[model samples]
Target: MYLEKIDAPQDLRGLTTEQLRALADEIREALLRKLSAHGGHIGPNLGMVEATIALHRVFDSPKDKIIYDVSHQSYVHKMLTGRREAFLDPADYDEVSGYTNPQESEHDHFTIGHTSTSVSLACGLAKARDLRGGSENVIAVIGDGSLSGGEAYEGLSNAGEAGTNLIVVVNDNEMSIAENHGGLYANLRELRESDGKAPCNFFRALGLDYLYVKEGNDIEALTAAFRQVKDTPRPVVVHIRTLKGKGYAPAERQKERFHWGMPFDLATGEPKAAGGGEDYCDLTGRFLLERMRTQPELVAITSGTPAVMGFTPERRREAGRQLVDVGIAEEHAVALASGIAKAGGRPVYGVYSTFIQRCYDQLSQDLCINGNPAVIAVFMGTAAGMNDATHLGFFDIPLLANIPNLVYLAPTCAEEYFAMLDWAIRQREHPVAVRVPGAAVVHRPGPFDTEYGELNRYRVERRGREVAILALGSFHALGEETADRLKTEAGIDATLVNPRYITGLDEELLEELLRDHRAVVTLEDGSLDGGFGEKIARRYGPTPMRVLNYGLRKEFADRYDLGELLRANRLTGEQIAEDVLRIVR
Candidate 1:
């Protein structure tokens, strides 16, 4: 009833403190219902309901631009801004995205999925407003985890030096993707414990004004803090201490566990155990941990997603000897690993393929130019064909492949990944990149040599007369399945070729295939333009190759199931088989 009545922030003006608390409960229940039906960033959104409501009550959205860093916590904001009906209906789940989208609402400014970008974005907005002779408050709601990024610090330093009119709200839940790390968290802890009376200041050191709110969930207190800083001429930092998964008991107990989870039981807050186990990330983590033990010089690092890569806190503690979690700072992690490698140490920086885009400069200059021999493990390299354009990992191979002295390796399965990891470790010639496929599917082990150009050739899964399927990474599975379907139903024996290297095209393998096969079908989980397929077209020019490239188009894809995206792209086994049959006839 309370939620239905709240069409806008003004509706909450007349409500008592108890009624406001009741509204928080209502929001939580709504979130639970939505998340149970359609899985999302449940715990983060639930934790921020009160804080978000308080923010809305104080600041006028659209007029006062609020930029949420890693905007997964902006679900409540969407609900308040006339999108609540979508939340109730499961079919309309696609109506509003999990992260902030400017197209969705005027209140939402920038579309930021990456962490620690709000401060810089907010400062730019504030500067633009001033230039246009307009008066609108610029507020950046960044998580405590985001503060660890070098970019956030760069923005803070700039804001301090320029004296811009900006309000930076640091939502201190003491967690990033996992538990917070770095020196800044210590300062936050001190400020929280001292009740905003601490002498030693991090924000003040950068010449910015500072205010700390010990209780972030206290609506009145948070509203009052906003009121105080409404028209402030100088940039200020509002340190708000809050609990992650505040209302939920299980989430609170296992804060890191519930940070970002799948669909779960509302009663116990435990995730439903999907039958199949052993993620590709887990296998990679185990392999890396085992390798690190024997090779003491080996140092493993991650940006912020240690958990996603299967490096839990327990595993980190057990293998704490050479593990380095640089918080949300990808740039620092890349450069630091390069430095370690330069000093005759083996440093492997394991990061999500999407996030690795941030460290392009470091990858090129720091590692590639120097030929540091740093082993870079790029997890989720192909985007699983399920991600939006924002979450695409397709660019990594193309970008890194062009870098001088960088040898890129694309493995078809977990077994090849482990073998490649071992090979990369032993090699001391150049910088090597191991691209891990999306899922862990079993495959028979082949001869894996560390010699740079050896794995570039394609693996022949089946021999055929007329057609050949050129597949990369997990696309090899689709190719094999397509071959099987062709044999059974279509009576077409298509040759399946697994290209292990995206950059170094196996000229020998391709020449052999082109000599024997009539047409070649290229399949990859990346952009169709300038991808592996295009590369093949360029290599063997204007022959009987008749290369039909199957990949993601040059557009921003929406969030969808991986399998569905594959089917949509005609990259599924049945789809590929049907296409092959048509081409053969």
Candidate 2:
């Protein structure tokens, strides 16, 4: 096979157009085979196969730097760059991560997993090359609806103004996770319809030379286009129109569902494993839809990732104008939600913990400072979330909790989560963020308080002397386990407390614990540094109370095993109980 004989981009240099086409076919087959068994980004990788081939054929990677924005489509690039074995062999399927990593190979310039960064990153690389008197082609391949991001524009504007040797390849698939949103996408559609000869081009408007290839999947056309701008002294954009989920029929039909997929059947393209019974995604969607029916002014906002908030395409249609998706722009989403709230409209911005990092300034300056009651539903804010270093969910605690005037709440179960959500939407006080349970959809049968006017009040689940176990949010289950372990193994009845709020401490409850509790153990499912546990430790810094903070350390864990990571951090009930025994003894 052409793929077997070819190892690197240099190998592709000698292959005939016919052979390259054959190789593209083989690469698609390999991608399908691996993606069918091992879940990863499906639509993006499938769409970029030909474009990636044309790229490797035209330029010298590691020398001529090619940066993929978000790098979700870098699987095809990886297969061509001496890592095809990982795709071909099932045993080696787990060898590479879903996103590009510089550690994996010299060919991969950056370890990127987020959106709208390629153009800016490539701009920096191009600037450095010009300064060093090095003449290597610096290419930024950005698409899959990444153009909507504000940074992409910033990068484009910078590159255009620099007039240096930088090539920005816009891979227009006309989709961004969900159907594209924003005015920039309309311009992209115009360019696609007019074959890049549109009078008002987004790229050209930014002062960059532009070329468009309607046949983005055709290797010959793509190669010729790349060759035209290959050592250009000025910045230019090669806008290629490619079909998302190009080869696979099922993927082509359901673009968003196949954007990132689970292990699926190769023939039918159906998921191999059925989804577990209940999940927070669906629950959040259902609840919000019901709420939207009653509240006309209620609006649900998402930063490109609508599914994270359980607003699927059908559900989105149901919600209609009430639901807004600001494509790949978290910063805008935060500010928009703030604006909506400021206008007396109830705005709930549903976002992933990782993505929320982009809106820190907006959360602080735009939302929190003004103290608009914008409900920010934070998904995957736990150690059990996306394990990739670039997409870790454990860091949001430090990022969100420390921000003044922002009240961050952590609910132990679905009942409490919705109750908090309802309250946040209704309340017109401080900016509220609810860290939705990251683990399984934990359902507890009980009445939860809908009103939360009084802040920093921790709920006591169990009263005991000697040892106090303060579990926050997702770690409440672990707190229960520790209490049971303390009872049976250590014969010590430990106090179990659920600290509902992450931003502020329950001073009253904490002060009362000093009377009977010898050691206060704080368990949080996030980084220990500047997290909920650290706040508790700081609260007892001056007092005689001994506070033990249990959580992940301050470090990036890349694609790590959840079990090993938890054990390493001593986050287990067994580990916490043992530590408590030492403190008591």
Candidate 3:
């Protein structure tokens, strides 16, 4: 193979057009094979093959720093930079992360996962290079999808006036997670039609010189475009139009489903693993589908990721005029929801907990301060099993619970989740956010009270005496197991309390526990630092109540095992039971 003969970009320097094309084919095959065996961002990687090859050939990589926006499309870049074996060999698949990591190789300039960051990051790198009196091309490759975020616009605004050796390559794949949103995509289409000669160019409007490539996949065209902008005095944008799922037939047909996939069949592009039955994603989607049909004033919103709300493209189409995809703009989604609520519209903005951090100010100021009745469903908010450091779900509680006027609720089961959603929509006083469970999707025929009108209240699930286990949200099951363990092993049936509300303390119920309970065990699925468990611990600190807080320590646990993390944190029922036994013995 041509790939075996090449170790780095320097080796690619001598390659003919034919050889580069063959290398691109090899890279695509490798991407498909690796993704089939171990799931990854296949669509982005497949589309980026030719463009990556062109960039590597045009610039000195380690010398000329190229930062990938979000870095989901950096798989091809990784393969070329002495990491081809990681793709080809089944044994080495786990060796590298799907995203660009500087720890992996010198060619990888930054550890990127989230969107709309590369332009700003590259601007900083360019500024440093200039300050050192060094001359190296600093390139920021941002996707059209990432441009939806306000951060990308801010970066573009800053880079336009940069006046240095920087190239911002806008990879116009015509897709984010879903189809591109907002007026910018219309402008991008205009640019594509004009062949970089558009009158009102977004890039040019920012004062940066602009160049466009009609065939972003054509090796020759991309090579020429990169060469034209190489070592340029001021910042310039090389906007290249490329196919998202370029070579792969299945991926090309269904881009969003293939965006990030589980291990799938290479032959049919079908998921190898069977999906579970009617999880929270499905439940939420069904509920909203009905809600939107009934309530004309109700709007469902997603910031690029429809999967978070279980709004598949089908669901989006079904919701029709009621669904609003604000693209990758989380801040705007929050503010938009706030505005919608303020105008007597019921807006439910479903977002991943990791992404919700982007809109803290909006959540606090726009939604909470005004006290608009907008429902924000925060998914993947647990401490463990998340793949990337940049995308941790545990910290949202600390960031969110502290915010006033935002009543953050945690649902123990699927029924409770829906009930909270129902109550949140009907309420017109506070900004309510529900912390949805991560992996363990438990469902009970809950018929939970649609009566969340009363605030800061907790429900006692399995009441007992001597020891009370206050499990917050998803940890309710763990609390039940702990109570059962205490009964079976220690002859002590501990009280299992489900603290459904996270933002406020159930002071009345908490005070009631002090009578019979000898010790209180607070279990939460987030970090102990500034989390629900610590809040409980602090509440009982001035009292004689012996509070044991079980949760993750304040630290970034990158790609952790669920079982090991639980055991390490003494969060497992057995571990908590053992701790309780020792304390009470």
TM-score of each: 0.94, 0.99, 0.98
Clashes of each: 0, 0, 1
List runs of model 2 lying over 4 Å from the truth.
Answer: none
Higher-scoring candidate on lDDT, 1 or 2: 2
lDDT of 2 by residue, 1-585 (tens): 989977888999999999999999999999999999998999999999999999999999879999999999999999989899999999999889988898899999889999999999999999999899999999999998899999999999999999989999999999999889999988988989998888988888888999999999999999999999999999999999999999999999999999999899999999999876788988999999999999999999988889988998889999999999988899999899999999999999989998999888999999999999899999999999899989999899999999999999999999999999999988999899999987588987777888887999888888898899888898889999999999999788888998899999898888998898889999988888989888888889998999899999999899899999999999888998898888788
TM-score of 1: 0.94
Residues 1-585 of candidate 3 have per-residue lDDT tens digits of 988777898889998999899989988888899999899898898889999999999999999999999999998898899998999899999888878888899999888889999999999999898899999999999994999988999998998887788899999999998899999999999999998787989888998999989999999999999999999998899999999888899999999888889899999988998886667777788899998888999999999988877888888888998999999999999999999999999999988888998999998888899998898999888864364777888788888999998899999888788888998999898889998866557887665889787999898888899899988888888888888898999799888888888998899989998888879998888878888888888899898888898887877666677787778778888889999988887
The C-alpha lDDT values of all candidates are 0.80, 0.92, 0.88
RMSD of each: 2.3, 0.8, 1.2
For candidate 2, what is the lDDT? 0.92
- What tens-digit string does per-residue lDDT give for candidate 1 at 504-582? 7787877887777767888886778777888888876867666678887766677767777677788777777777777
The numbered model that scores best in lDDT is 2
